[model samples]
Target: ISVWTTLAALLGGMLAADVVLGVTPAYFFAALPRAVAISNLWLALGKSMVFGLSIALIGCHYGLRVKPNTESLGQGTTASVVTAITVVLLVDAVFAVVFKNVGL
Candidate 1:
């Protein structure tokens, strides 16, 4: 779902930009392959997948740690949210460093 949504947003934005710039669909399609390489596309998809997986795992882990009390539930939820954000940022930083010259 995340991959599909990202692709949709990417293509939609590209199409909108082309239309606004008075570029035809044919020209847009022709330029797209050269505009973004396959490796870059795969990198984006892989990052999204990792982010999604980390978030899901964190949520599930904290969720199971929750007790029957409301307090535990609230604390578990807060911890999960905070941890997920932190993990995503760290993962993104790692990716940036690792792929610094990927498209260069």
Candidate 2:
């Protein structure tokens, strides 16, 4: 899913820049430090995988804590969403900090 989305983002962003911003794909990619593109791709993929895992884990945890009542289900869903978002942000921050020197 991340791969497909990333690919789509690349293509769409490239086309949008070409049409709307007058930036060619070559210039877009060339903006990165030479040979840093692949590392950036790997970094994005790794972060996405971690985000997916964290969200899934949070969802399963909250889901398992729900009682049979509708109120419990609603509360569990809300908690799951909140926790997932929080965890994703934390993970992203950690990734940013850890990769501060990466691909530089």
Which structure among the candidates has the greatest lDDT? 1
The most accurate candidate by TM-score is 1
lDDT of 1: 0.89
User: Candidate 2 clash total?
Assistant: 0
Computed on alpha carbons, the lDDT of every model, listed in order, comes to 0.89, 0.88
lDDT of 1 at 33: 76
The sequence of per-residue lDDT tens digits that candidate 2 reaches over residues 4-61 is 9988987897789899999988998787446455788889899988899899999999
lDDT of 2 at 25: 87
Lowest-sum lDDT 10-residue window in model 1: 22-31
Error of 1 at 22 (Å): 0.5
CA error at residue 70 for candidate 1, angstroms: 0.7
lDDT for predicted candidate 2 compared with the true structure:
0.88
Model 2, TM vs. native: 0.84
